[model samples]
Target: MRNAHRVEQVRAAEAELMARLPEGALMQRAAAGLAATCARLLTRRRGRVYGSRVVVLAGSGDNGGDALYAGAVLARRGARVSAVLLAPERAHAGGLAALRAAHGQVVLDQEVGLADFSRADLVLDGIVGIGGRGGLRAEAVPYARAARRGTVVAVDVPSGVDADTGEVAGVALRADVTVCFGTYKPGLLIDPGAGYAGAVQLVGIGLDLPPADVSALQHPAVAELLPEPGAESDKYRRGVVGVAAGSATYPGAALLAVAGALHGGAGAVRYVGTAAEEVVRRFPETLVTEGGPAGAGRVQAWVVGPGGGEGARQALAEALASDVPVLVDADGLTELGRLGPGALAGRTAPTLLTPHTGEAARLLAGADGGAPPPADELAAARLATARRLAAAYRATVLLKGSTTVVADPGGAARVNPTGTSWLATAGSGDVLAGLAGSLLAAGLPVLDAASVAAYLHGLAGRHAASTPGAPVTALQVAAALPAVWRQVRASATADE
Candidate 1:
C-alpha cells in the first residue's frame, strides 16, 4: 500500500525530525534528492546537464529554499541556472547566497522571469508550498499561463492545491513531475490536484509517522487480499453472489452485471429480477430465479440496482432486509437517496454504496433534506465527499470518478491507482458493482471488496482499451477481467 498523510500530519512529522537533526541536515537531504531527480530528468531530456537552461521559481518559504539550494547543485554541475524570486525580500538568505556563490543568475523582474520560464529546458516550481491555499499569488499567475518548452518539477505538492483535500479553488500550476518529501500527500493521490501532478516521486527525509488515514493499494497488497478457494472448497463453500437488477426497459444491465460476477472470484451467481430470461439466454451458467431478492434461494451477498427502472425500490428494500451484505448501485442508489440514511438503520449486515458524483449529490441531499449540490462541487473535493457520504449513510462508499475513492464511516479511505479514461463508457459501473458485490460474497470486508474490485475493474478497462486504443464496449471490459486477474496474480507471485 502507498500511504498518504494529511498536511497537519506531515508538518508534525517534519518538525519532529528536524528537531533531532543538525540545523541544516534535513533540508540538505531534501535538496540532494531534488537535485538528483532533476539531474536524471535532464540527462534523459538531452545528453547532459551541461549548458542546459534551468529556471527556479522561488517563493518566500522553505519550499523556495529547497529549490534554490537544488539549483545551486545543478549550477555547480555546469547547468546555466537562473532564480526568479516571487518574494525577493523574504527569500531564504542562505539559499540566495549559495546560488550566487555558484554563479547562478538571479532575476527580480517579473518580465525577465516570465521570459526565462517560457524557454528554460527545465523549470522548478516553488512559488507556493503545501501550506499555501486558494491559488497562485498575483505575482506568480503569469507562470501558470506561460508557454513552456520543458518539464516542470514541483518542489512538493503542486502550488495552490490543497495538500489535505486535493481541492484546487483557483488557477494552479501543472507539473510534469512532483518530488514530495517524507510521504505522499493526500492531494497528490486524489483527483483534480492529481491531474495537475503528472508523475509523483517520493523522497523520504526519514520521519517517524503514525498510521495514514489515506492509502492506495499496489499490486502486492491487492494480491494478498484476493480470495482463493481451499482444497475442500465446493461451489457453495466458495460463496454465491445474488444479483437483483434490470427490468423490461433495460435487460442488458442484468447481463452485464452477471458477466462481471462470474469472474469475480465467487463460485456461482444467483440472479433474480425481471430480466431473468435475457440473463439466462446470455449467461446460461447463471442460476436465474423469478421475482425479487426475497425469493432468491440462498446467497452470500446481494448486488441490487443497475438499470432496475421501476423495480429498483422494491429490490433495494428486499436486499437490505436480507441478513447478508448488500451492495447498492445505479437506480438502487436513486431509491436509497429518496428513502434517506434511515433506510439502512435497521440492517445489521454490511452495505456498500457506489455512486458517481451525480448520484452522490442526491444521496447527500437525501441525508440533509435540501436541494442537491452541484456535481462538479462534490467532485472537486472527492475525499471529503466520499467520507461525508459514508458517515451520513453509515456505510462504506465507493465514489467512482476520475479517481475511485473508497471510504468507511470511520474516515479510513483508499484511493484506487489503476484505471483509464475509457472506463467511463456506459454500463462500466454496473460491471464494477457486480464485481465488488461478488467479492463481498466471497467474504472480503466492505472496504477491501470495494477497493479490490476497483483495482481489477480499472486494470480490465485499461486492457480492453490497450494497443489500438479503440473504444470498447461494457462487455469487452468484463471479458478482459480474467486476463487481468491472471496478470495481477502472476506479477505478485513473481515478485515473491
Candidate 2:
C-alpha cells in the first residue's frame, strides 16, 4: 500500500525532519530533485540544456523557496532562469538571495507578462504546496491557465488542488509531471487532482512516516489480493458465481456481466434473469436457470440487478437472504433504501452495495434519514460517502465513479489507482459488478474483492483502449483480464 498522508500528517513529518536536519538541508534536497527532473524534461524536449528558458512562478511559502533554489541550479547549468513572483513582498528571502547569487533574474509578474510564457521552455509551478487552500489566488490563476501543454512541474501537490481531499476548489495548474517530496498526498492518488497530477515521481527526503491516515493501493497490493490457481484445485474448488441480472429491456447488461465473470476466474457462471437466452447465445458456458437465484442450486455468491425486470424487489430480497454473500448494483442499489436500514442492520451475511453518486444521494436522504451531504467532488468525497453508506446500510459500500473507492465497514478505504476515462462507455458498470462478484465467490472479503476487481477492470480497459478507436467494449475489457493478471502476477522483485 502507498501511504498518502493528510496535510496535517505531512506537516508533522516535516517538523520531525526539520528538528533533526541541518538548516537548508531539506530545502536543498527538494530543490536538487526538482532541478534534476526539470533538466531531464528539458533534455527530452529540446535536446539541449543551456539555451532553455525556465520560468518559476514564485509564491510566499517554502514552495516558492524550492523553486528559487531549483532556479539557481538551472542557472548554474547555463539555462536562463527567471522568477515571476506572485507574492513579491513575501517571497522566500533566502532563496531569492541564493538565486541572485547564482545569476538568476527577478522580474515582476506584470514586467515579463503572459507573452513570455509561450517562449519559455518550461514552467516550475511553485505557487503552492500542501499549505495551499482553494485555487491559485486571484493573481496566479491567469498564468496557470495560460500554461497549456508546457512542461509544467508542480513542487509538491499542484497549485490550487486540495491536498487532503483531491478537490479542485478553483482553477488548478495541470502538471506534466509532479516531483513529490517526503510522501504522497491523498490528492495525488484520488481523481480530479490525480488526473491533474499526470505522472508522479517520488523523491525520498528520509522522512520516516508511519502508516497513512489514508492511502491508495499500488500494483504490489493488487498482486497480494489476487487468487492463484493451484495444481490441486479443481474447477469446483475455485468457485462458482451466480449472476441474477438483466431484463428484456436491457439484455446487454446480462451479456457484459457474464463476459466479466468468465474472466474473473470463476469455475462457472449460472445465470438467473429474463436475459437467459441472451446469455446462452453470447456464452454457451453460462447455465441458465428457469426459476430464480434460490432455485439455481448452490452458489458461493450472487450478483444482483444489473438491469432488473418486473418483480425485481422479490428476487433481490431473496438473494440478500441467501447464506452466501451478495453484491447489489444498478436498480438493486436504488431500491436498497427499501431494505430500510433494519434489514441491512440485522443481516448476518456480508453484503456489498455498489452505487454511483445519484443513487447514493437518494439512498442517503431518507425521510427519517436526514439531508444528504453535498456530493463529493469525486472520489475525494467517496471515503466520506462510503463511510456514511456503510454506517447507514450496514454493508461494505463501493462508490463507483472516476476513482472507485472501496470502503470497509470500519471506514478504512482504498482509492483505485488504475481506472481510465475510457471506461465511461455503456455496460461497463455491469462488467465491473460481475468481476467483483466473482472475487467474492472466490473467497476474498468485500473490500478486497471490490477493490481488486476495480483495479483489474481499469487495467483491462486501458489495455483494450491501446487499440485505436477500439472503445474498450465490455467484452474487450473482459478479454484483456488475463493479460492484466499476467502483468501483475509476474514474480519480480520490487526493484525490478
Candidate 3:
C-alpha cells in the first residue's frame, strides 16, 4: 500500500524528527534528493547537467530554502543556476548565503525571473508549500501563465494545493514531476491537486509517522486481498452474490451487472429483477429468481440498484433489511437519498454506497432536506465529500469519478490509482457495482471490497481500451476482468 499523510500529520512528524537531528540535517537530506532528481532529469533531457540553465522560483518559507539549497548543489556541478526570489527580504537567509557562495545568480526583478523561467533547462517551483492554501500570490501568478520550454519540478506538495485535502481553490502551478519529502501527501495522491502533479517521486527523509488515514493499494496488496478457493471449497463455500438490478427500459443493466459478478470470484450469481429474461439469455449460468431480494432465497450478499428504475426502492429496502452485507448503487442510491440516512439506520450488516458526484449531491441533500449542491463543487472536494456521505449514512462510500475514493465512516480511506478517462462510459458503473458486491459476498471487509473492486475495475477498463485505444462497451470492460485478474496475480507472484 502507498500511504499518504495529511499536512498536520506531516508537520508533527517533521517537528519530532528535527528535534533529534542536527539543525540543518533534515533540510540537507531533502535538498540532496531534490537535486539528485533534477540532475537525472537534466541528464535525460540533454547530455549532462554541466552548463545547463537551472532556475529556482524561491518563496518565503523552507520550501524555498529547499529549492535554493538544491540550486547551490547544481551550481557546484557546473550548471548555470539562477534563483528568483519572490520575497527577497523574507527568503531563507541560510539558503541565500549558500547559493551566493556557490556563485548562483540571484534575480530580484520579476521580468528577469519570467525570462529565465521561460528558457531554463529546468525550473524548481517553491512558490508555496503544503501549508500555503487558496492560490498563487500576485507576484507568482505570472510564472503560472508564462510558457516554459523546460521541465518544472515541484518541492514537496505543489503550490496552492491543499496537501490535506487535494483541493485546488484557484490557479496552481502544474509540475512535470513532484519530489515529496518524508512521505506522500494526501493532495499528491488525489485529483485536482493530483491532476497538476504529472508524476510523483517519494524521497524518504526518515520521519517516524503513525498510520495513514488515506492509502492507494498496490498490486501486491490487492493480490493478497483477492479470494482463492481451497481444495475443499464447493460452489456454496466460495460465496454466492445476489444481484437485484435492471428494469423493462434498461434490461442491459442487469446483463452487464451479472456479467461482472460472474467474473468477480463469486461461485454463483442469483439475479432477481425485471430483466431476468435478458440476463439469462446472455449469462445462462446465473440462477434467475422472481420478485424482490426478500424472496431471492439464499445469498451471501446483495447488490441493489443499477437500472432498477421503479423497483429500486423496494429492492434497496429488502437488501438493507437482510442480515448480510449490501452494496447500493445507481437508482438504488437515488432512492436511499430520498429516504435519507434513517432508511439505513436499523441495519446491522455492512452497507456500501457507490455514487458518482451527481448522485453524491443528492445523497448529501437528502441528509439535510436542502437543495443539492452542485456536482462540480462536490467533485472538487472529493475526499471531504466521500467522508461526509459516509458519516451521514454511517456506511462505507465509494465516490467514483476522476478519482475513486472509498471512505469508511470511521475515517479510514483508500484512493484508487488505476482509473482512466475511458471509464466514463455507459453501463460501466453497473459492472463495478456487481464486482464490488461479489467481493463483499466473498468475505472482504466493506472497505477492502470496495477498494479492490475499484482497482480491478479500473485496470479492466484500461485493458479494454488498450487495443486501438478507442471507446469500449461495458461488456468489453467486464470481459477484460479475468485477464487483468490473472495479470495482477502473476505480477504479484513474480515480485514475491
Candidate 4:
C-alpha cells in the first residue's frame, strides 16, 4: 500500500524526528535525497550534471531551504547553479551562506529569474510548500510560467495545490518530477494536484509517522485481498452476487455489470431486472429472473441500480432491506438521494455507494438539503467529498473519476492508482459496481472490496486501451479483467 498523510500529520512526524536528530540533520537528509534525485534526472536529460545550468526558485520556507541547499551540492559538483529568491528578506540564512560558499549565484530580480529559468537545464520549484493555499503569489507567478524547456522538479509538493485536498485553487506549477520527503502527501496522489505532479518519488527522511488514513493499493497488497477458493470449496461456497440493473431500454447496462460480476470471483451471478432476456442471451451462465432484489432467490450480496430507469427506487429499497451486503450505483444513487440516510438506517450488513462526481453532488445536496457544490469542485476535493458522503450515509463510498477514492464512514480511505482516462467510457461504472458488489459477496471487507474492484477495473481499462491510449468500450474492459487478475496473481506468486 502507498500511504499518504495530511500536512498536519507530516508536520507532527517531522517535529518528532527533528527533536531526536541533531540540528540540520533532517534538512541535510532531505537535501541529500533531493540533490541525488536531481542529479539523476540531470544525467538522464543531458548525460551529465557537471556544467549543467540549474535554477532554483526559492521562496521563504523550509522548502526553499531544501532547494537552496540542494543547489549548493550540485554547484560543488561543477554544475552552474543559480537561485532566484522570491522572498529575499526571508531567505534561509544558513542555506544562502552554504550556496554562496559553493559559488552558486543568487539573484532577486524577477526578470533575471525568468531569464535563468528559460535557459536552465533544470528548475527546482520551491516557491510554495505543502501548507500554501490559493495560487502562486504575485512575485512567483511569472517565473512559474517562464520555465517551459527544462525539467521542473517540485520540492515536497507542487506549489498552489491544496496538499490535503488535491485542489488547485488557481494557477499551479506543473512538475515533471516531484520529490516528497518522509511521506507522500495526498495532493501528489489525488487529481488536479496529481495532474500537476508528473512522476512522484518519495524519499524516506526517517520520520516515524502513524499509519495513513488514506492509501492506494499496489499489486501485492491487492493480490493478498483477492478472493481464492479453498480445497473444500464448492460453487455455493465461493459466493453468489445478485445484480438488479437495466431496463428494457438499456439492457446493455445489465450486460456490462454482469460481465464484471462474472469475473469477480463470485461463484454465480443472479440477474434480476427487465433486461433478463438480453443478459441471458449474452451471458447464458447468468441465473436470470425478472423480479426485484427481495425475490431474487439467495445471494451473498446485491448490486442495485445501473440503468434501472423507473424501477431504481424500489430496487434500491428492496436491496437495502436485505440482510446481505449491498452496493448502490448509477440510478440507484439517484433514488438513494430521495430516501436520504434513513434508507440505510438499521442495516447490519455493509453498504457501499459508488458515485461519479455528478451523482456525488446530488447525494451531497440531498444529504444536506442544500444545493450541491459544483461537480468540478467536488472532483478537485475528492478526498473530503468522499469522506463527507461516507459519514453522511454511514456507508462506504467509491467516488469515481480520473482517480477512484474509496472511503469508509469511519475515515479509512483508499485512492486507486491504476486507472486510465479511457475508463470514462459508457457503462464503465456499471462494470465497476458489479465487480465491487461481487467482491463484497466474496467476503472482502467493504473497503477492501471497493479498493480491489477499483484496482482491477483500472488495470483492465489500461489493458483495453493498450499503449498510446486507444478508445475502449466498457465490454473490452470487462473482457480484460480475467487476464489482469491472472497477471496479478502470477506476479504475487513469483515474488514469493
Candidate 5:
C-alpha cells in the first residue's frame, strides 16, 4: 500500500526531524533537493543551466522559501533567475538573503512582464504549501495560467489544491512535475489534484515520517489480496457468487455482472432477477434462480443491483439483511439512500458500498446530523469517511474513481492505484461490483477485498482496451481477468 501522511502528521514528523537537526537543516535539505530536480530537468532538456530564464512564483511560506533557495542554486549555475513575489512583505527572510547572495532578483507587483514568464524555460510554483488554505488567490491565478503555457514545476504541492482532499475550490495551478518533500500528501496521490500534479517526485528531506495510518494499494498489496485456490478446494470451497441484477428491460447488466464474477474464481454464480433466463442462455454455467437473494440461498456472497429497475429496491433491502458479505453497486447505491445505513448497522456481516462521486455526495448529505469533525476535506479521508459510515451504520465504504479508496469500519483505509480513464465505460461498474462480491465471498476482509478487486478490475479494463475508441465490453473485461491475475502473480514471484 502507498502510504499517505496528512499535513498535520507531516508537520509533526517535520517537527521531530527539525528538533534533532541543526536549525534550518530540514528546509536546506528540502531546498537542495528541489534545486537538484531543477538541475536534472535542465540537463535532460540539454539546455543551459546558465542564462536559461527561471521564474519563481514566490508566496508567503516555506514553499516559497524552497523556491527561493532553489533559485539561488540555479543563479550560481548561471541561470538568470527572477522571483515573482506574490506577497513581498511576507517572504521568507532567510530565503531572500540566500537569493540576494546568489544574484537572484525579486520582481514585485506586476513589474515583471508576463512576457518574461512566457520566455522562461521553467516556472517554479511556490505559491502554497501543505499549510495553505483554499485556492490560488485572485492575483495569482492569472500567472499560474500563464506558467501552464511553459514547463511548470511545483514545490511540495501545486498551488490551489486542497492538500488533504484533492478538491479544487477555485483556480488551481497545473504542473509538469511536483517535487514533494518527505512522504507523500494525499494531494499528490488522489485525483483531480493528482492529475494536475503531473509526474510526482519525492525529494529525500531525510525526515522519518510517521508510518501512514491509511495507505493506498501498491502493486505488492494487490498481489497479496487476490485469491489463490488450493488443490483440495472444490467450487464450493473456492466460493460461489449470487447475483441479483438486471430487469427484463436491462438483461445486459445481468450478463455483464455475471461475466465479472465468472473469473472471480467462484465455483458457480446463481443469477436471480428478470434477467435470469438471459444469463442462463448466455453462460449456461450460471444457475438461474427464479427468486432473488432469499431464494438464491447458500451462496458465499451476494452482488446486488446493477440493472434492477424498480425491482432493485426490494433486492437491495434483502441483500443488506443477509448475513453474508454483500457488495452494493449502481442502482443498489440509490436503494441504499432509501433504506439508509440503518438497515445494515445491526447486522453482523460486512457491507460494501461502491459509490462514485455523485453517490458519495448523496450519502454524506443523508448523514447530516452526525458527530462533528474537521471540515469535509479531512473527513473525506478514507479512514474518516469509512469509519464514520461504518460506525454510523456498519459497512465498508469503497468510494470509487481515479483514486479508489476502501475504508473499513474502524481502522485504516486502502486506495487502489490500478485504474485509468478506460474503465469509465457503461456497465463497467457492474463488473467491479460483481468481482468485489466474489472476493468478499471468498473470505477476504472488506477493505482488502474491495481495493484489490478494484486493482484487478482496472488491469482487466486496460488489457481489454484494444484500440482507441474501441468499445471495452464487460465480457471482454472479464475475459481479460486471467491476464491481469497472472500479471500480478508474476510480478509478485519476480519480486521475491
Candidate 6:
C-alpha cells in the first residue's frame, strides 16, 4: 500500500524528526536525495551530469532551500548551475551561501531565467511546496512555461496543485517527474494534480508518520481480500449476486453487467430485469427472472441501476429496502437523488454508491439543496468530491474517472492507480457496478469491495486494450477479468 499524508500531518512528522537530529541534518538528507535523483535523471537524459546546465527555481521556503543546496552539490561536481530566485531576499540563507560558495551563478532577471530554463539540461521547480496553493506566482509562471526542451523536475509537488485535494485552481507547473520527500501526498495520487505530475519518485527522510489519510492497495493486499472458495464451499456458499439492470430498450447494459458479475468472485449470478432473454442468451449459467428484486429468490447482494431507465426508481427502492448489501449505479443513482438521505435512514445493511462525475454532481445537489459544481470541476477535485458525497449519504462512494477514488463515511479513502484511458467505453461503468456488487456479495466490506473491484477492473481494461492500450469494448474488459484475477492471485502467492 502507498500511503499519502496531508500537509499538516507531514509537517508534524517532520518537526518531530527534526527535533531528534542535529541542526540542518534533515534538510541535508533531503538535499542529498534530491541531488542524487537529479544526477540520475541527468545521466539518463544527456549521458552525463558533467557540463550539464542546471537551473534551480528557488522560492522562499524549505522547498527552495532543498533545491539551492542540491544546486550547490551539482555545482561542486562540475555541472554549470544557476539559481533563479522568485524571492531572492527571503531565500534560505544557508542554502544560498552554500550555492554561492560552490560558485553557482545567481541572478534575479526573469528573461535570463527563461533563457536558462529553455536551454538547461534540467530545471528544478522549487518555487512552491506542498503548503503552496493556487498557481505559480507571476514571476515563476514564465519559467514554468519556458522549460520546453529539458526535463522539469518538481520538488515535493508541482507548484499550484492542492496537496490535500488534488485540485488545480489556476495555472500549475507541469513536471516530467516529481521527487516527493518523506511520503506520497494525496495530490500526487489523485487527478488534475496527478495529471500534471507525470511520474513520481518517493525519497524517504525517515519521518515516522501516522496512518495514511489516503491509501492505495497493490496486488498482495487485494489478493488477501479476494474471496477464495474452500473445500466445503458450494455455489451458494461461495456467494450469489443479484443484478437488477437494463430495460427492454437497452438490453446490452444487462448483458455487460451480467458479464462482469459472472467473472467476478461470485459463484452464481441471479439477474432480474426486463432484459432477461438477452442476459440468458449470453450467459446460460445466470439464473434469470423477469420479476422484481423482491421475488429474485436468495442473493447475498444486489446491484441496481445500469440501464434500468424508467424502472430504476422501483428497483432502487426494492434493493434499498432489502437487508443485504446493495450497490447503486447509473440511472439508479439519478433516482436516488429524489429521496435524498431519507431513503437510507434506518437501513442496517451497507449501501455502496457508484457515481461518475455527473451523477456525483446530482447527488451533491440533492443533498445540499443547491446546484452542484460542473462535472469537470468535480473531477479536478476528486478526493473532496468523493468524500463529500460519502459523508452526505453516509455511505461508501466510488468516484470513477481517470483516478478512481473510494471514500467511506468514516473518512478512510483509497485511490486506485491501475486504469488506462481505454476504459472510457460506453458500458464500462456497468461492468464495474456488477463486479463491485459481486465483491459485496462475497462478504467484503463496502469500501474494500469497491476499491478491489476498481483495481481489478482497471487491470482488466489494460489487458483488454493491448500494449500501450487500444480501444476496447466493455464486454472485452469483462472477458479479461478472469485472466487478470488469476494473474493478480498468482503474483501474490509467488511473492510468498
Tens digit of per-residue lDDT, candidate 6, span 1-496? 8899999999999999999999999999999999999999999998888999999999998999999999999999889999999998899999999999999999898888888888988989899999998887788777656647888899999998888888898888899999999999999999989988888999999999999969999999999999999999988888999999998777889999999999889889999999888888889999987688988899999999999998999999998889999999999999988778778889899999999999999998889888967999899889989999999999999999999999999899999989889999999999999999999998999999999999999999999997976899999999999999999999998999
The lDDT for every candidate, in the order shown, is 0.94, 0.83, 0.94, 0.92, 0.80, 0.92
In terms of lDDT, the poorest run of 10 residues in model 4 is 139-148
Q: Model 3: runs farther than 4 Å from truth?
A: none
**Total clashes in model 5, counting residue pairs 3 or more apart in sequence or in different chains:** 2
Tell me which of candidates 2 and 6 scores higher on lDDT. 6
Query: Residue-wise lDDT of candidate 4 within 238-303, one digit each (tens)?
Result: 899999999877889999999999999988999999988888999999998767988889899999
TM-score of 6: 0.98
Residue range with the least summed lDDT across 10 consecutive positions in model 6: 139-148
Which should have the higher lDDT, number 4 or number 5? 4
Native-to-model Cα distance after best TM-score fit, residue 383 in candidate 2, in Å: 4.4
Off by over 4 Å in 4: none
Which lDDT value does model 5 have at 97?
A: 91
Worst 10 residues of 2 by lDDT: 372-381
- Kindly list the per-residue Cα lDDT of model 3 for residues 175-234, writing each as its tens digit: 999999998989998998998888999999999999999999999999999999999997
> Please, what are the lDDT tens digits per residue for candidate 1 over residues 1-496?
8999987898898889889999988888999999999999999999899999999999998999999999999999999999999999999888889999999999999999999999999999988888888988899989999999989999998898888888999989999999999999999999999998889999988979899999999999888988899999987888899999888888899899999999899999999988888889899999988879999889999999999999999999989999999999999999999999999998889999999999999999999999999999999999999999999999999999999999999999999999999988989999999999899999999999999999999999999999657788899999999999988889899999
What's the residue-level lDDT of 431 in candidate 1?
96
Clashing pairs in 6: none
Clashes of each: 0, 0, 0, 0, 2, 0
